[model samples]
Target: MKRSDGLKMKLVDTYTMERVVAGSASRYPKRIALRTYAEEGSELTYSELKRKSDAVSLYFLEQGFVKGDRIALIGESCPNWMLAYFGLTGIGLTAVPVLPEFSPKEILHILQDGGVKAVVVNARHVEKILPFIRKKPEFLIRLEDLFHIPMPISGELKDRNQFLNAPGRDITRRKVDAKARQLLSEHRPKEEDPASLIYTSGTTGMSKAVMLTHRNLVWNADISSDVYFKVKPGYKALSILPVSHVYEFTIGQVLALLCGCEIVYLGRPPAPSSLLPALKEVRPHIIMTVPLLIEKIYRSSVLPTLKANPKLQRYLRFGITRRFIFRIIGRKLIVTMGGRVRFFGIGGAPLDREVEAFLAEAKFPYALGYGLTETSPLISGGKPKNHTVGVIGKIVEHLEVRLEEKDPATGIGEIAVKGPSVMQGYWNNPALNEEAFTPDGFFKTGDLGFIDKKGRLAIKGRTKTMILGSGGENIYPELIEAVINNQDFVTESLVIPEGGALVALIKLDIEAFAEKMALSVNEAKSEAARYLNKLREEVNKELNVFSRLSKVHLQEDAFERTPTQKIKRFLYLRKKDESSDA
Candidate 1:
C-alpha cells in the first residue's frame, strides 16, 4: 500500500484471501505485517508472509490434499498460525480455527465433526488431541516453523514434545518445481467458497461449526473499515482477544491487513504486568478486546479511586464537574494505555452501564459493538466518537436488519439479519440450518433487541434466557445481573428463576472485603452472607418490581464462562435437586 498519507486506496475486486494476500504483497511487500509484542525476532513482512503461506499451500497440494478439504488450526495467536490459515484458505482448503482453551473432549469433538484431514498445531496444544489418536488425523504439522510432525514411534502416543521435536519433513525445505509454481500462480478460489469453518463457544452448552465463506469474511472486513475509525499505513493494532473468535479474526486481523496496519500479538495473556508494558512499547493506534477486560480495569482501578476521595465523591454528584473530573482521569488512562490509542473496540458481550457511562463522560475512546459468530460477527458498530452510550451503532452498509415479532409495549424482539457477511449455514446440520433462518432467508440471531428512533441497535437479552413473570411480563436476567454486578463488593453475579421467583447468585470481592474489614476468609464469608440481603435490596431498587430479586445467595465458586467471558446460563439453570445453594 502507498503511504496513505494523502493518497486514495484503490478497492480490490475479488473478496478472497488470495486476492487480499496478493494485493498486500504487491503494494507493500516490505511493510511489517505481523509480530509478537515481547519477542525480538518474530516479525513477518507482507512479502515474507505471502511466500511462507504459498510454500505451505504448495506442500499441501503436493501431499494430495485437494480443494474443499478441512484442516484444523490449533494454537495461540501467532504469525505462524496466520500463515497456516492463509495457506489453507488461499489454496481453496477450509481452515477450521479451534480455540486453544477447549478441553480434550471438545477438541476431539471439533476434529471429528469438522472432518479434519490434517492438524496444524503448536506444541502447547498437542496434549488436547492426544487422547483420541485413533479418530484423529494422521498428518500433523507443527505450527512453530511449518514442519511436518510425524506420528509417534510404534503408532503410540508417548510425549508431545517428542512429536514436536521429531520433525519428519520441513514444508519450506523442498524446492518449488516449475509445474507446482505455475499451478499455484494460476489457482484462484471463487468468492463463495468456504474459507473458514468456525465452531462457536456456545453459552447454551451446545456447539456448532459456522461455515463462513470468502465473501462473508472479506466483505465484512471491508465494510467494517468504513464503520470504525480510519487508519493509515504502518498504524499499530494490539490484538488481545482470541483469534479463533470471529470478533477478533475479522476486526483485528483482516481489517488491519486491509488497512496496511501492523498487528502486534501478546506473548501471553494480557494481565496488567505484561499488558501495561506492551501498551507502552507498541503504543497501538487500535485495540480489540471484550468488555470484561475494560470492566475489570474500571472496577478495580478507576471506581475505587473516585469513591475513596471525599471531595471528589461529593463533586461527582454534579454532572458538569463530574465529567470534567472523569476527563482528567481518562487522560491518565490513555497514557497508561500507551497514549496513542484511537479506536478501542469492545464486543463479544454487553458492557456494564456504569463502565459505559464513565467511558462516555471521561472522553475515553471506547466503541461498543453487537454481533454473533453467525453474521461474520459485526452487525452493528461505529467509531468511538460516534457511539451512543446505551446503543450499539447503526447496522453496517448492505445489510438488512429488523426486529422479529416485536412487542408493542417494549418494542423488543428477536434480531434477524440478512447480508453478504452472513455465514452459509451450520456445517452438516440440516435440522439446525432449517431452524436458524426464516422462510424469507433472514438468519434469526436468537437475541432480543430493537432499533432505536436514532437508528441505533440496543440489545435486550437472549430469547432462551428470558424468563416469564407470573403476570406474563418478560424478565431479562442479564439486565438484573447488570444491576447486581455494579453493586459495591460484588465481583460478578448470575440471576436465575427458581420456583417462579428470580434468585441471584452473587460472587463477592472476598479480597477487598477481607482487606477493608481486617477479617479472615471465614469471617469474610460470614460478613458477605450478612450483606447479601442489603445488596439485593440495593439492586432491586434499580430494577422493575417484577424483575426484583427474591433471594440472594453467596456463590462460593466462580461461574463458568465462554471464551467471550459470558456466563454459561445453561450450566447454572440446574434442577431443584442439584442446587448447590449456600
Candidate 2:
C-alpha cells in the first residue's frame, strides 16, 4: 500500500505483531529503540528490545501460557511495560492494558471482566491486586523482575537471579528461544485475531473493554505514519501520556517504532519540573500530548505576560505585529520544549479556542486529532501545514465516515464510522455491541459534530453531555465552559443543568484574584462573588439565549477528572443538590 508520502509500505494485513517488531529489528537493529527516565535512565536498542521481549515470551511459554490466553498489564508507562506488551502480543496472547490511575475497584472490575488469566504488574500496584489474586488470576509477575525471573507461577521460586542462573532456567530459556524462532519462521497471527483489549477510562460511567485485532491497531499505525507526519529515521519522541490509552499506545509507541523513532518514556508525571529537564535532555522531535498539558503551559506562561503588558496586548490586535511578537516568544517556548519539535500533536480532548489561537499565531507546529478508542483513536487529523484552528483537519485516509440523524438547521448529528481500524466490538457485552453499531455496520461514535464544506470535522459536543435547556433548546456545555474558562481569574469551569437552568461550577484563581483586588481572604471571597455575577452577565451576552449560564458558583476544589484529565461530568451531575454558593 502507498502512504500519503508516496512511500510504498507493506499493508498490516500481510503481517502480525511479531513480524512488525522483527521487520523493524532487521532494519534498525543497532538504533536506540526505547528509553526510560528514572533515577538512572535506561536505553534499549531495537535488537535488545526484541531479545528481551523474546526472553520474556519464553518464560511465559515455559510456564504453560498459550495463544489466546488473556494477560493483564498494569503500570505506569516505562520500558518494561512496552517490553511485556510486545512479549505478550508478539506471540498471539491478548494483552489487556489497565491504566495505573484507575481505582482499586475499577482495576478489579476490569481484571474480572476481561477474564484475565495472568497479570504483569509493577511493584507499586501489587498490593492493590493481591487481595483479588486468589480469586481472579492464576498468577502474577512483577515487571521489574521480568528479566531475572525464570517462570511466573505463584509461590514457585522466590530467588530471581538464582533461578535465572539455575540449570533448569538455562534449559527452559534454550527451549523457549528455539520455539520462538520456530513460531516466527512458521506461524504468524491472522489479521482477525484479537491483539489487545483496551478499557475506556469511563469519564461518564462504567468502562467497557474494546477488542482490537492486530489489523485494527497495525493498520491505523501504518496509515498514520504515512499521512500524519513525516517519518524521519532516528526521530525522537517523548511519550508523556499514559501508554494504556489507545491514543498513545498506537501512535506514540507502535507507530514510532514502525517509523524508526526512538521513544523516551517519562518515568515521572509530565509536570513542569520533570518535563522541562526531560525536554532539555532528550531534545525530542515530536511530542504527543493532550490539550490540558499545552493549555496549562499557555495559561501559566504566555497568558499572564500578555495580560500584564498593555503594549504587547495592543500589538496582538494587529496581525503583522502579533506574528512578530509571538514568533519571538514561540522560539523561546520551543527552546524550553527541547528546541527541535516539528510536531506537537494534541488529542484526547478539545483544545480551548484561545489556547489554539495562540498556538496558530505563534506559528507553532501544532496538530489536532479527533477520535474515540473504538476507532483505534485516529478518526481525523492532519499535518500542521494543513491544519485549521478549531477543526480536526480531515478524515484520515481509508476510513468511511458519516453523520446520522442530522439536524437541518445546524447539520449536527452523531458521527458514525466504518474502517479496518475500528474495533470488533466491546468485549463480553453483546447488548453494547449491538447498540454500538448501525444496521449498516458503521460504529456509532456518540459524538456530535458536522463536517465543513472543506471536509474539516468540527466537533459540537458529546451526545451524552449535551444539556437540554428549560425551553427545550440544545445547549452544549463545552461551548459555554470555553467562554467561562477564557475569562480572567477563572482556572476551569463546568456548566451543568440545575433546576432547568444552566449553572456553572467554576474554579477560580483565588490567590491571583485576591492580589489583583487588594483584598483579604474573606474580602476576596466576597469580591469574587460580585465579580462572578458581573462576569456571568458578560459571558451570557456572548452565548445564545438557550446556552447562557444562569448562575456561576465557585468551587474551592478542582473538579474530579478521569485518567485522561477529562472532567468526570457524571460525578458532578449527581452532586447538583450539594451545589455551594459563590
Candidate 3:
C-alpha cells in the first residue's frame, strides 16, 4: 500500500515483530531507531536495536526461560522497555506489559492471572512486585540498567546476577554472536502465535487479559502506518501515552518502527515542566496522545488565554472571524509543540466537543481514532484533512465494520468488526471468548456508534454505561458530560442515575474558581456549590428532558479513571443520599 508520503510499503513475508524490526534494521541500518527525549548519546540505531534485542533474547535463553512463557514488563515508557518487549516477543515469549500506574494489588492480580514466569521491572516499580516475587515469577531483571536484580532468603530461584556482572559479556554489553543468533532463530514465533497479553483497564470493573497474536499486532501496524497516517522514514516520533496500552503500542511504537521513524521516549511523565523542554529539543515530526492531554491543554491554557482576550472574544462571536482567529492561534500551538509536527494523533477516549471544534476550525493536524484493545485498537481513523468535528473518520483499510442491531431512527448500534487485527481471544477465559464475538466470527465491540452520511464513524458511548430513562429512552452520560465539561470552571464531570433521575457530579477547576471568585479555598468551596447548581440549570436547557440532571453535586476529588482517562463508571454507579457539597 502507498503511504501518505506516496511511498509504497512492501508486504512483509511474515507478520511478526521480529520481521518488523529485522526489516527496518536491514533497510536502515545506520538510522537512529530509539532514544530518550533530549538525552544525547542515548540513541540506538536500527541495527543496534536489533542486536541489543537479540542480546536480550539470548540472555533470557541463557536464564532457562523459553518461548510461550509469559514475561511481565512493568515500567514507564523508555528505550529499554521497547528492547525488552522486542526481545521477548521476537523469541516467541508472550509479553505481559503491566501499567506502571497500577496499584500493588492490581499488579499482583495481573502477574497471577497471566502466570508471569519472569519480570523485567523498572527500579521505581519494583516495590509493587516485591511481595509477589515468591508467588510465581522466578526471575527479576531491572529495566533501568538491564541487569539481574538479586533476591535473597528464598534461594528458590537461580541467581543470574553473576552472568550479568561477568567482565567479558555483561547483560547490557553482551553481543549476540553467530551461535547465540542461531539459537534464538530456532524459537522464531509463527504469525498466529500470541505476541502480547494485555489486560483491559476495566472501566466496568471486569479486567481480562487480551491475547493479541503476531499477525494481529503486525498487520494493524502495517496497514495503519502504510494506509492511514502520513509518517516518513527518518521522521521523529515523540511518544507520550503509556506503551502498555495497545492504542500507543500499535500505532505509536510499532508503526513508527515499521515506517523506520526514530522514536523518542519521554522516560517520565509528560508534565509541562519536562515535556515542554523535550518538545523543543526533539522537534518531533509525529506525536500520539489521548484526548485528556489535549483537552487539558485546551481547558487550562488555550481556552482561558483566548477568553481572557477581550478582542478575540468579540471576534470569536462570528463564524468566519472565529475560525480566522483560531487559525492564528493554531499556528502558535504548532510552534509550541516543537514547530515540526505533521500528525497529532488523539485516541483512547473521545475528544471534547469544544477542543475538537477549536482544532477543526484552527486546521490543527489533530486526528481522531476509535477502537478497543480487541481490535489491536484501530477500527476507524483519518488524517486531519478528512476529519469532521464529531466523527472519527473512515473505517480502516481491509477491515469489515458493521453496526449491529441498528436503530432505525438514531442509526446508532453496537460496533462489530472482523479483521486480521482482531484478537485471538481472552487468555484462559473461554466463556468470555464465546461472548466477545458473534456466532459468525465478528468481534462485538460493545461501543455504541453510527456511521454518518459521510461514512465516518461517530461514537455515542459504551453500551454498558448507557442508562435507561423512565420512559425507556437511552441516556448517554458521555454526551451529557461532554456538554458539562465544556462549561467554564468545569474540569470534568460524570452523569449517573440516582433515585430514578439523572445526577451530575462535577469536578471544578479550583484555581479558576478561586481566581474568578477572589476567595480562599474554604470560601470557594461554598461558592462552588452555588455555581454548580447554576451550571446544572444552564446545562439542562441544552439537554433533552430525560437526560437533564435532577441534582448537581460537587465532586471534591477527581473521578477515578482508567489509563485512558475514562471514568470507571462501575465505581460511581450506585446512588448516594449525601448532601451536595464540595
Candidates in order, TM-scores: namely 0.96, 0.93, 0.94
Looking at model 2, residue 538 earns an lDDT score of: 93
lDDT of 1 at 439: 98
Error of 1 at 426 (Å): 0.5
User: Candidate 1 lDDT, tens digit per residue, 331-405?
Assistant: 999999999988899999999988999999999999988889899889999668844677888888778998999
Candidate 3 per-residue lDDT over residues 1-582, each given as its tens digit: 554533234645578999998999998899999998766677899998898888888887888878899999998888888988998988899999898889989999998889888888765777677667766435777777677655443223323343234222246566777887789889888989999999988688888999999989888888777566667899999988889999999999988998889999987788999999989888988999988899988888898898899998998999999999889988998999899988999999889988999999989998889988999989999786655788898898778889898989999999999988899999999999999999999999989999987788899998899999999999999999999998998999988888789988899988779988899888999899889989999999999899999899999998999998888888887435343321
Tell me the deviation in Å of residue 561 in model 1. 0.8
Report lDDT per candidate. Answer: 0.86, 0.82, 0.85
Q: Residue 8 deviation, candidate 2, in Å?
A: 8.2
Superposed model 2: Cα runs more than 4 Å off: 2-15, 38-41, 136-138, 147-180, 183-187, 577-582
Q: Locate the minimum summed-lDDT window of 10 residues in model 3.
A: 160-169
